[model samples]
Target: MYVVFFYQGLATHLSAKKSALEQLDGYRLRLRKSEEEFHHKEDERHVVAETLKKANAENSVKTAVESDGEEEDEEDADAGSEEDGSRGYTPSPTPAKSRAGSHVSPT
Candidate 1:
């Protein structure tokens, strides 16, 4: 009877230990899954951030190019106007050439 009781007690203790180990394993698995999810989220955030940065840089370059084109167009228009003005205006005769052999007569 004493031996039987001892054997039963030992069996019960082993069963309890098995249950505790199973619980610990389940907790470890949950922790590992949570860690994997965290890493995935971090990678996604990095990708999004990189994409936004690239888009902003592209937009800035486009804006700079457009502004430069506008400045060039304005300069071209100013040059054209200057050319037109030069072509349309004639210089007046110089005073010395106009009075080369002329004497003023009293009236």
Candidate 2:
């Protein structure tokens, strides 16, 4: 009778240990899945950040190019006006004035 009771107790203890191991395995699986999900989200965020950075850089370049084109057009317009003014503004030539720092010796 005593041996039988000992065997029965041992069986109960083994069953409890088995169930505990199963529970531990389930928790570990859940933790692994959550970690994988977290890493995946981080990767997605990194991709989004990189894409936005590229877009901003492209926009900045585009704006810079547009401003440069506008500057060129304004310069062209200014040059055209200067040309027109020069066409009507010929002045009479005057004799050269003597400079105080002149070093020319008469030939």
Candidate 3:
């Protein structure tokens, strides 16, 4: 748009200035098209990055939930074993783990 006035200021021959203005307009159009393509690709990249982040967050949450559930199950099993031991119930055939140094014979 500036060339609309710039051409008037140029002292060069009218034909030469007109040709130059036309070339400038073509270059401007190509630059604008290139910028549009660049912006579009940037936007696509951003969307993909956001989606990947969301997926990772979801996976992290799910993994934490599963870990907590497994820990609770292990706790329940350990509590049940402790209760049986305290009550002096007969040990299961699999046997309980012996305490450290319990194999020492009394004098």
Candidate 4:
């Protein structure tokens, strides 16, 4: 009778150890899944940040182009005014003025 009880107790202890090992395995699997989810979310965030940076750079280039065009137009207008100012007008000589100046001699 004593030997039978000792064997039964040993079997019970082994069964309990097996149940604990199964629970630990389940917890380990859950932790791995959570870590994978965290990495996936981090990758998505990086992609979004890169896209936004590209968009902002494109917008800045477009703004610079538009500003350069406006400056060129202003310069063209100023050059046209300067050209007009440089050309002075001259009056034509009349027939009476030519006849009077023809006989005039300085001594």
Candidate 5:
């Protein structure tokens, strides 16, 4: 009778151990899946961030080019106005005389 009770106890212990091992395996699988999802999301975020940086750089370059073009246009307009002299305004001769007078050495 005692031998039968010992055998039953051993069987029960083995069954419990097997159940615990299965639970541990299930938990490990869930953790691995969660980690994989997190990595995937991180990769996507990096890609988007890089894309945004590139777009911003391109926009800044375009803006700089446009600003330079505007400056050149304004310079051209000023030069054109000066050459045509259609505004009925004559430039003063005093500035040229002053520059020449300054070059004369005082004896």
Candidate 6:
């Protein structure tokens, strides 16, 4: 009778250990899945950051080109005005002075 009881107790203890090992395996699988998701998200974030950096660099170059074009236009306008001045083009008088002179009051 004692031998039978000992065998039953041993069986129960082995069964509990097997159940615990299965639970640990389930937890390890979930941990692996979570780690995989985390790595994928990190990779996506890195791609987005790189794309933004490339766009920023392109915009900086575009802005510099536009500024250079504006400077060239301003220089051309200044040169044109200087040419006009050298040709002795007299500026027109203001409308108020012209009207006052046109209406000379007889004193």
lDDT of 6 by residue, 1-107 (tens): 99999999999999999999999999999999999999999999999999999999999999999999999998887778788784434678776645545675799
List pairs with backbone clashes in candidate 2: none
**Winner on TM-score (1 vs 4):** 1
Deviation in Å, model 2, residue 40 alpha carbon: 1.2
lDDT of each: 0.92, 0.93, 0.88, 0.88, 0.91, 0.91
Give the lDDT of residue 2 in candidate 4.
92
Clashes of each: 0, 0, 0, 0, 0, 0
lDDT of 1 by residue, 1-107 (tens): 99999999999999999999999999999999999999999999999999999999999999999999999998887787788785434589876665667789998
Best by lDDT: 2
List CA RMSD, all candidates.
8.1, 6.3, 10.6, 10.4, 7.0, 4.1
Roughly what TM-score does model 2 have, to 2 decimal places? 0.73
Worst 10 residues of 6 by lDDT: 95-104
Candidate closer to the true structure by lDDT (higher is better), 2 or 4 = 2
TM-score-superior candidate, 5 or 6: 6
Among the numbered candidates, top TM-score falls to: 6
Candidate 4 lDDT by residue in tens digits, 1-107: 99999999999999999999999999999999999999999999999999999999999999999999999998887777678873333457765655645585787
Lowest lDDT block of 10, candidate 2:
81-90
Q: Over the full model, what C-alpha lDDT does candidate 3 score relative to the true structure?
A: 0.88
List TM-score per model, in order: 0.69, 0.73, 0.65, 0.67, 0.72, 0.75
Q: Which regions of candidate 4 are displaced past 4 Å?
A: 86-107
RMSD of 6: 4.1
Minimal lDDT window, size 10, model 4: 86-95
lDDT of 5 at 45: 100
Q: Write the per-residue lDDT of candidate 5 for residues 6-73, one digit (tens) a residue.
A: 99999999999999999999999999999999999999999999999999999999999999999999
